[model samples]
Target chain A: MKLLNKILFGSLSAIFLLSGYDGFSQAPDKGSLSVAINYFNDNNKIPYVLVRVKTKVNGKFKTVPGIPLKLFLNKDSAGLLIGKVVTNESGEATSFIPPSLKKEWSATIKHSFHASFMGNTKYDSTSADLTVGKAKILIDTVGRSVVATVLELKDTSWTPVKGVDVMLAVKRLGADLNINETATFATDSTGKASGDFKRDTIPGDLKGNITLVAKVVDNDQFGNLSIEKTVHWGSKFVSKANDFNERTLFATRAKAPVWLLFIALGIIIAVWTVLILLVQNILRIKKLGQEA
Target chain B: MKNSKSIASDEQIIQDLLPRKFKTSGRIWVSLLIAICLVGIYAYYRQLRYGLAVTNMRDYVSWGIYISNFVFFVAISLVGSLITAVFRLAGVKWGAPLTRIAEMIAVAAIIFASIIIIVDMGSPERFYNLFIYGRIQSPIIWDVIVITTYFFISILLLYYPLLPDIKILLRFKEKSGPGLHKFYSFLGSFWTGSHKQYLLSKKAIYALCVAIIPVAFTIHTVTSWLFATTYRPGWDSTNFGAYFIAGAFLVGAGSVVVAMYIFRTWYHLEKYITPDHFDKMGRVLVLLCLLYLYFNVNEFLTPFFKMKESEAGYLNDMFSGSFAPVFWFAIFTGILLPIIILLFKQGRKPLPMFIVGIMVVVGAWFKRYLIVTPTLLHPFMPMHDVPEMYHHYFPSWEEWAITSGSLAGAMLIITLLCRIFPIVPIQETINEHHETAK
Candidate 1:
C-alpha cells in the first residue's frame, strides 16, 4: 500500500511537471511581429513597407516618425525623390510606388520622435537593405470590368486571369527610324490591363513616337482568359510626363459572411446536451422511487 | 400423459439441467468460432499496419460496411430490453423462458457493437482521445456516452436474474467444474435465497428495467443522429430517430425468435420454449415490422416526392439508380415479405417464424448498409481531383475478415455464456411450472 501510494504520487507529479513544460513552451515571442496585409491592386502590384525607428522614451534611443525620408535607386544621384508624407495614427504611411523600379534596389526611411519634456530628442535613421521583385498581374475578361461601363455589357461578367505574359508594342508615324517601343504588361483582378512603358527614361522628342499594343499570350489553368489591346499615339497625349503610372483600378464588393452556419450548430449542441441531462435526472429519480 | 407421469423431483431436475461440459459438436463449434476470431485478429493487425487504406474507404466514402454492421449489432441487442424488461413489466408469462436467451443475445451483441465501432474508427489507437478531447458537440461522442451506459445496465439486468440460477449451478459441482463452481459460488454464494436478498435483487432488476428503456432509446437515437445531424440528403431527416428505433426492435425481436428456435432444437427445450412462445414472438415481429415500414415510408417517400436539389442524388441512388437492387431487396425481404408471412396464424409457428426471423435479420443488415453508404456517396460537393479509386468503394479482404470475425466473436460469447450457465433459467422455468400446476 505504501509503495502504491509513492508510485501514484510520483506519476501525478510527473504529469504536472510535463504539463508545466508544455505551457511554458507555448509562450509567444515578444520581439517578432505577426503581420498580414490585404490590399487592392490598381494594376497588378501593391507595395507596402515596414518601418521601425528607435526612440529615447525609455529603451534603445534612435529616430522617430514624421521625418524626411528619401529613397534612392542606385549610387547615382539621378534617382527621383518618390514622395514626402507624415505617418498616420499607426505610426505608418502606405502609398503606391511606381512600377518603374521593378528590379533590385535599397531604401532608407529617416524620421524623429519627440520626448515628453521636449528635450534633445534622438534622431534615428533606419535603413532597410531591400530587393523589390516583379509582382504578378492578373486579368479577368469574363467578370465585370471598366470596359463594361463604356460598352454597356450588362448581361456579361468579366473575370480576371492571373499569371499571363502580355507585351505592348508601339510605333510612331513621323519618325524616320521605326522606333520599336515595347513594354511587357499584365492585367489586374478585374481584367483591366496596365504596364510600365518607361516614358521618363526616353527623351521628350521620342516620346511622341509611341503607339501601344497589349497582347496577352496565355491564360492560367483555372480557365481565366488573356486579352490584348492597342493604344494609339494620338489618344490622350500628355507631354512632359515625369513618372509613368501603370496601375489599373478595379471595383470590388463585399461577400456574405460564413459564420452563421457555425452559430446554428453551436446552439443545437447546447440544447441537446441540456435535454440529455434532464432525461438522466428524471430517470434516476424514478429508479430511486422504485427501489424505495 | 406418459411424459407427465415421468415427472422428476426438483433435485433430479436440477441434476439433469445443470450446465455440462461441451460435447463433440460443441467442441467443434467452439474451435471454428475461435479460428474465425483469430483470423479476424490478424486482419485487424493488417488494418492497423496500413491505416484505413487497407479498406476500400476513401475521402468521399468515409464510412463503410463496418458502420452498418455496428448498427445491426446495436439493433439486435435491443431484444434483451424487449424480452426481459418490456415483457416482464407487462406480466407476460410466456416470455419467461425466453428472457435469459434474449439477455444473452443482448450481452453478446452489445459487446460486439462496442468492438465493431472501435474497428470503424480511423485512429483506433487514439480511442482515448474520445475521452480526453471528446467534444460534446459531436454526435459520435453522444453515441459513445449512451452506448456505454446501455451496456452496463443490460449487464446488470442479465446478472440480477441469473443469481438464483448461479446458486443452483453451485450445487452441481461435478457438472460445473471446480473452477466454474468456485466462480458461481463467489458470485452468488451469499445469495442464500433469503427474502431480503430476493427483495433487493428484484428491486434492482426492476430499477434497471425502467432505467434501460430510456438508455436503450438514447443509444439508437444517438446512432441515428450520427447520420441525421449530417447534411446528407437521405440521412438528414427528422424521422430518422423513430425509423432507426422501429427497425432496431424488428431486428432485435427477429433475433430472439431465431435464438429461441436454436436453443429449443439443440438443448431439447421443446417443453420450455413452446410453440406459443414462437407465435407470440411472431406477432411481436409483425407489429415491429409494420412500425418500421411506416417509418421507412415517412423517411423516404416525403423527400422522394419533393426531389429537392440536395436530396435528388441520394434519393435517386437508392430508388432506381446504382443502389436500386439492394434498396428493393431490403424493403421486400426486411419488411414487406416478413409482414406478409407472419400475418398468417400458420406462419407464426416455430418453423415459419424461424425463416421469417432469418429474413428480417439479414434484410436489416442490408438496410443499415443502405442507410450508411448511399448518403455518403452523395455528399454536397462533387467528388473531384482525387484518385480514381476514391469515387467508388468496396470492402477489402481485411474488412471482410474483421467483420466476419466480430460476428463469430459474438456467437462465441453466446456459446460460452450458455456453457457456463443454463441458456434458459432452470429455476425460473421450474417456478413457472409450479405456478401453472397450482
Candidate 2:
C-alpha cells in the first residue's frame, strides 16, 4: 500500500505539471497585418493615387495572400462604408474607382479613402487612410458648339487633366428639364473637349431659350463634373401679321388678330355710344322744368 | 285688392320711405366695417412690401380666396339685372319694390369686384397694362368690357328710378339734414316731375330694360368663359356657361333676399316689403336652386361616369378624398338644403328664409373656394420641386384678412347707399299701390 501511494502521488504531480505546460503552449499566436495602397499602373507612380490594396504579414514581412479588406470613404460630414476585396495571388487587390463615387465625391475637395481589416483571433485589426485631390470642371458655349474643360485644382492653381472622358448634352428648359441630345468626347492634353448639335434640331421655350449641359465623368484623376448654359438658339415664332386662327387665340404671347380687334372695338364702341347717349339724356333731364 | 282710396297718402308714403340718418346700431356696423377695412389695408401693405409671397399662393395654387371673392361679387351683382331688367321686361309687379335694393347690391358688389381683382394682381401699379397691352382675344379683356358696360347700366338703372323720389325728398328739406338736402338737390333738383319729363324718363327706362337683358347674360356667360377656357378637369366643359349663369342667379337672388330682410327690419318698412315679398323671393330662390342643382348634376355626374384619366383624380378628391368635406358641405348646404327649406310654406317666412338665404350665400362663398383651389391642386402634371406645404393649401391670415376686408367694403358701400337713398323706393311704391288699387 505504501508503494502504490508513492506511485499515485508521483503520477498526479507529473500530470499537474504537464497541464501547466499545455496552457503555456496554447497562448494565442501574435501575427501582424499591414496594408499599403498604391496607384494600379505598370509604373506604380506615386502621389497620383489609384486604387491598389496590398497586405504583408509574418516576421519576415513577406506578402500574404487571400486576406479580405474593406474600403471606406471618409469625409468631414459623413463616411461611406463599401464592399470587401480579397487579395489576389500576388497579395494585391486592384479596382477602378466607381463612377457614382466620382460624382458624389465632387463636393469634397480632398476625399480621404480608408482600408481596414477586422482581424480574426490570430491577427490584430489595422486601418489606413489615403487622401486624393478633386478635379474642377468649366463649361462654355461658342456658337452652336459646347466646350468643357477639366482641370485639377491644387492649392490655388489649375492644371489640365488629360484623356478625361466628357459628355455634352442639350436639354429642354421647361418643368421636366428633359434631355434632347447627348454625345461623348474625350479630353486632349489641354483638358479641353468640344461637341456641336444643330440649333434647329434643339427645341426651346416660346421666347427661344435653350439649355446646353457639359459633363466629365468617370475619370481617375478628375471625377465627375458638370456645367450648364442657357442661350437663345432655337426656333423663333412665326409671323402672325396675316394669320387669324385658333392658335392666335391660344398663343401665350399677345398678337391680337384683326377680327378680334374689330369685335372688341365694335363692342366697346357700341357700349360707349349707348353710355354717351344715356349721359346726354340724363343731362337733358335738367332741362325738364324749362320745358314745362 | 284694396282700393286706391285705402292706400296711404303720397305724403305719408314719403314720410315712411324717404332716406333717413343711421341709428346707433348703424353707426356701430359702419365702424366695425371700417375697422375691418383698416386691418385689410395693413395686410395688403404687408403683401405689397413682400410681394404675393406673403399669401399662401405659390406657383401651383396661384389663384386663391381673392379670386373666389371676386367671382362671388360678380355673381351677386347679377341680381340687379334680374330684378330691374328681367322682371320689369316681364311686367312683374311684385319686383318693383325690390329693384332698388337689387341695384344697390349690384353696384356695391361690382365696384368691389373690380377692386378685388386689382388686389389679386401681383402688381397693381401696372393696371394700365390691361389697356395698353391688353389682348382683346383674352377672356379677361372680355370680362373687363362686360363688367364696365354692366356697371354703367346698373348706375343708370339705380339713378333713373330715383328721380321722382329725389324730388319728393326735396320737398321735405327739414327731414333731410342740410348736407343730405344739398346732396339730393345736386342729384335731382332739375326734376320738375312734369308729364313730359315723366314720359321721356319712362321711355328711357323702357329702352334700358330692353338692352340690359342681353348684357346681363353676356356678363355671366363671359365670366364662365374665363374658367371654361382652361383645360382643367372641373372647368373644361361645354356646360359651364349655363351652369355659371344658374348659380349666379341663385346666389344673386339669395343676396337680394338677405338685403330685403335687413332693410325691412332696420328701416321698419315691413309694410312696404311685405311677407308676400319674402314668400315670392323664397319661391324664386327655390326655383333657382333647383335649376342650379340640375346644372351641378350635369357638371359632376356625367363627368364621373366618363371618369377620364385626367379628371378621375380631381373628381375623386372632390367626392371621397381630401376635399370631400368642403365639397359635400357646399353641395348640401348651398343647393340641396336651401331647396328643401324653401319648398315649405313655413320656410318661406321672413325669418326662416333669411336663415336659408344666409346658408346659400355662405355656402356659395365656400363653393367658389372649392371650385378654384382643388382644380389647381389636381393639375395635369404632378406637383413636384415645390415646398411640401404647397402640396396642400389653407388660406393664410393675410388672405383671410384681405378677403374679409373686401367683403366688408362691399357691405360698407351698401350700408352708406341705404342711408342715403330710400331702400324701398318711395315714389315707385306709391305709384305701384295706386295702380294696384285702380
Assess each prediction's global lDDT (C-alpha) against the native.
0.68, 0.81
Q: Give one digit per residue, the lDDT tens place, for model 1 in B335-426.
A: 99999999999999999999999999999999998999888888877766888877667789988899999999999999899889888787
Task: Single out the weakest 10-residue window by summed lDDT for candidate 1 chain A.
Answer: A144-153
RMSD of 1: 22.7
- DockQ of all candidate complexes: 0.02, 0.29
Off by over 4 Å in 1: A1-292, B1-9, B12-16
lDDT of 1 at B425: 80
lDDT of 2 at B412: 96
Stretches > 4 Å off in candidate 2: A1-247, A251-254, B1-6
Q: How well does candidate 2 score on lDDT at residue B422?
A: 90
Span of ten consecutive residues with least summed lDDT in model 2 chain B? B1-10
